[model samples]
Target: MVKWDTLARPKEFGELGFLDTRAMNTVLLAKRTSHIDGCEDSPCIKILEKKKVLERNFFRTSHRGGSQFWQGLQEVKCWYERGRGCTVNCGERVKFRKDVWLGDCALKTSFPYLYQIYRERQCSVADAWERDWSLEFRRNLGQEEMVEWADLSGRLE
Candidate 1:
């Protein structure tokens, strides 16, 4: 008898082209969680609402308590969060350094040294904008650092 692992392999690998059920389940759950924001009519969402699971942010909500399906949904939220990104509008809801608003990655990742010296790491986009983009740092920028700062400044504009 062929082992399940062999049966689950791709046809090109000289085995059956059946999908691994666990991996398929994970992919489906990730897909569901990724689109949960727009699926207001989903029965799973309704169940979460009935169970008071929608009281907090879906990504921030605890996965510790709920039905089997709810637990499964929560388990895939990390994948959802990783793939999701924010687009700044009002700016109040978007985090300046921690969120992926300005570019492909978070500002902290883009400018690690500047982020290290930044005073208000948790400040919102609105807070930084209101400050005229003159964010306070722990110390003055050195000559070499000034060049780096200029790059960051140019990106902001």
Candidate 2:
């Protein structure tokens, strides 16, 4: 069985991608106790119930629209910030630098075969960082100067 942590990582082994932690947490919560029937005795259900109670109280005291509920639903923010170890203030600004070549990054070096596959697909460095490289591009790059081009690119991830 695949470990949840492994699945939580960016799709590819070598890519510089990261899973959003908040999203992962929500998934964990939702999947905490899977059963044939939708029983409410699961840990996830209990936590969700507690969350609902807190939200109700919060809304009653303050005019907030249960921001935590919305935030919990939109797990992107927490995932990006905690998963990547990025500063919470401006995590969105931390994207894979396009000009960087995969060959030079330590993450790529650790997973050379995967990175090579990514380069063969002629994927942009940014795409590689996001683990979005396409198999079609990989096939095309086998006949092109993709490796060289990726190597020569000035930026590093």
Candidate 3:
């Protein structure tokens, strides 16, 4: 019998360029998840709704033990969250610093080192305004950080 791996490789690499069934399945399912935001009536979504598995936020839900199909949906959700993240409209659900609500990139991604070091800055955007940042760090930023912060601040304002 021919090796499956050999057939799965690209034609450019001297192989048959046959599509990987498992990978194709994953891509198709992930594509379907995009329709989750639409009006498409799916049995899988109904099951999740019945189970109360994140009626709003799919990322908040977990895949502990349940349907394998549900698990696959969660995997697609993981891909979505990591890529698109979330936008700050009311600033209620979106997490400040912890989520990518500010701009094109996440605060944590833009300033990975700063995010790890800053303890008081991690909170929901709503809470930050309510508390008025009593414990907000007033420490002077490094020249590079100041540049980065300025760039980020400019976009938000």
At residue 10, give the lDDT of candidate 2: 68
Number of backbone collisions per candidate:
0, 6, 0
Ranking by TM-score: 1, 3, 2
- Per-model CA lDDT versus the true structure: 0.79, 0.39, 0.67
* lDDT tens readout by residue for model 3, 6-80: 999999999999989988877777776766643337776676688877477554667776678778877776666
TM-score of 2: 0.20
Writing each residue's lDDT as its tens digit, candidate 1 over 1-157 gives: 7788989999999888898998888889888786665567788678778878887547557879777778888887766656568868788767788777877878887887778888897698999999889889889977756766898899988
RMSD of 2: 18.0
Which ranges of candidate 1 are over 4 A from the true structure? Answer: 1-7, 39-46, 116-123, 134-149
RMSD of 3: 4.1
How high is each candidate's TM-score? 0.68, 0.20, 0.66
lDDT of 3: 0.67
How far does residue 119 in candidate 3 sit from its true spot (Å)?
3.1
